[model samples]
Target chain A: MSLKKEGPDPKDWSGYTVGLNFGMSAIVGMLFGLWADSAFGTKPWGVLIGLFMGMVAGFRVMWQATMSNTEELGEKNQTENEAKKTDKTDV
Target chain B: MSLDPLHQFEIHKVYDLSLMGYDISLTNQSIWMLGTSLVLCLLMMVGSLKTAKVPSRMQGFVEVTIDFIQSMVKDTAGKEGLKLLPFVATVFLFIAALNLVGMIPGSFTSTSSLYINGALALTVFVLVWIIGLFKHGFKFFGMFCPAGTPILMMPLIVPLEIISFFARPATLTVRLAANMVAGHVLLKIFAFFCIAMGAFFAVPFIPLLAITALEIFVALLQAYIFTILTCVYLNDALHLH
Candidate 1:
């Protein structure tokens, strides 16, 4: 039952933040697309493009964040291993 | 007799003032924000005013909170993130204070409004944008591409990345504001049930108590989530990841 709080853990990042990003992007895209459709009278095509763009952005954010977290965890593990090796040498 | 759950959110002008073509009058929401911030500052300052080898409960609480925010910044933004600690700490404390105060019956919840949330979110949005550009110069655009993005796919990927960038503040604004509104509305409904049932109102009262406790947890959680996300975005600004 350790009460100590550590620096950012990959596990600490919740799916909700990611979901917030994805869901909002979709909404932003759809609404903006609709606005553009009316402005340009492009109607269906404008909205379709906007929705597609939003989905692309939303997925990309999730993908990029996951990729970066993986890289960060790998680096953290490498550092821990190195430190452990130094402790062994000292012992 | 009445259960208008959203009635709590209404703004009433205490001293209605029309300045030429503009309306700038004092409202309950404004007072709540001001009072919450003043009390928060006074307490945080007074709690740690005395330094001793043995800390009192107030001092201990203040120190722990400071440490928590400091570590959050360090963890999310790395070493350079320490520069934003004061700002991050202030934001967390202010929001948390408004939330706790709001829980007191009839007190206004300033943090529940989208206008307040939007302003705070936009400030973070602008601040991080400026910080990233200042720190990395033109290379700040590299944040959008991430690593290993092929040059040929830049056109398609770049726009998606840009849209995602815009989503940052929008999500931040929505998460906090929406949570507060939903929780308070539910609490109001349960409370209305508790009182309206009279002799049999105990059943509804129990759930109301539970919801009130849950609302408190949410207030703290929302503050924390908002602060940590700020740190994460600041990290992105500093490190371009």
Candidate 2:
């Protein structure tokens, strides 16, 4: 038995992230459902609008997730460069 | 005509101190936040100490969660940031656990509070700034202003970037708080329908149950969103690009 962690390759982690986003969106949708129900006295109809908002929110999260990974990679490179400079100075 | 739902926000003084100009009121929100913190601490202690060859169901769940966050970091932040695995993993567990715990009946979710989210966001914001400084020195400020913009566009782009940078915490806070408050408010309102529309209508309870389950899913999802966003922010700070 390997001690290594399993499930979800890092490159494809976006998919799971996407699922999480959708789940969150649904929660928001429920809220929207409630708000709309109260405001218009139309119970589930508000939920429909909320669900749409949630979908859009999820997409926003997905967009952020996509950009974040690339940015982290860039920070790591900077760290490496700084380290190299420090080493050269010491030598 | 009805009790203000927002009345729940009221605060009562728990301690009086005249010297420091600080009145420590143990607000309902504060109590809820404390409850969340205690639950998180207990869960951490249990999950961390429980190591087994076969693993109990709870332990298995914990292991799976760790693996999920770890993989997420590696994929987004890359192999270089594998060093931050511990921090990333812990944040994920803590936030996710806190969010999910709120799904329990009669539990108040601290993450749903703007105060809590703001605090968390501030911590992350500070962490990113410090990490960037450590790696890039004063150059870290450049994170607010990306490179390669034309000098003519500098005035517009730079300020816009700065505003966006500042808005990160607000965005994070609103995302978590709005979801929590909204979901619970809906649940409470529907539950009211069960009682208010007279005892004859049992139908509302079914939707309430369904929403409760959905709330559970929301708990986990919000936690995931919080953690993943942290990773993304960490990635940005680390990379400075």
Candidate 3:
């Protein structure tokens, strides 16, 4: 009997977390930027820079999440393909 | 009933206490949190009091929960993550219990408070930092810069990476707290509608029941998400890539 587990992969659960992570990263970046500006008296430059950094951070998170998901999918496909090849040889 | 849906989140002082200049008064939030922990402890103790080969219902439950968490840790962080099974299990069970308990009518959801969730997230953040620093030393900083990045891009990438790194705890805290608060407020609003509708109270009652069920699911899901994310962060610390 195969020991392979059934049901959705646990890693798939991480997908639910992406939306919030993206928004929060941007907000946190901007907040940090604002604080830096107030401390250094840079005013608008700080906010602009911070906001940009936050957006970049947000995109980075989305990219990472997408990359990991695709990696998992690739692995799953590889295993399935190998299994199919073995079955074909048996037939 | 109060039409204000957010009224459910108000923290009321149950006992007055102070230390030095700090107000250490016991509030409803603290009481509920304590109650949840105590109940969880009692359940755990009761569930494992007797061991059997065949396994009784309580023993089976305990085993299943631990096994589930163990597999989760293993899957996410690999073999080394199993070392953290007890910690991860405790966190998952505690948050799940707190969220489920909060679903009780008239009970305060301690997790709905930003401060509590913030503290929980910060705990995980500090733990990750300690583990990463201890395990990798100065090499851990290398995580901020991905592999194969040109030196020219480092200036832009480093700050973005740093911001995202710090954002982890913030995201964790906000996600859990916001989910709990939003679910509870939604339930409260629907409940108010069920009462305020008077003649057509049944109209809102159906949706209220559905929302309650959804809230319960969210409670479990949020807890699971929080624990899994903790494991993921721990993975980064353990395996730097």
- Higher-ranked by DockQ: 2 or 3: 3
Per-model chain B TM-scores are 0.94, 0.85, 0.97
Summing lDDT over every window of 10 consecutive residues in candidate 2 chain A, give the lowest-scoring window. A1-10
Tens-digit lDDT track of model 2 for B200-228? 55788889899989988887777776667
Docking class of 3: acceptable
Those runs of model 3 whose alpha carbons end farther than 4 Å from true positions after fitting are A1-14, A71-91
DockQ of 1: 0.41
Clashing pairs in 3: none
Poorest 10 consecutive residues by lDDT, candidate 3 chain B: B63-72
Over A21-56, each residue of candidate 2 has an lDDT whose tens digit, in order, gives 555555655565687799889877777766665555
Kindly list the per-residue Cα lDDT of model 3 for residues A53-84, writing each as its tens digit: 89888888788878889999899899999999
List the lowest-lDDT window of 10 residues for candidate 1 chain B. B1-10
lDDT of 1 at B202: 93
Which candidate achieves the best DockQ against the true structure?
Answer: 3
lDDT of each: 0.84, 0.69, 0.87
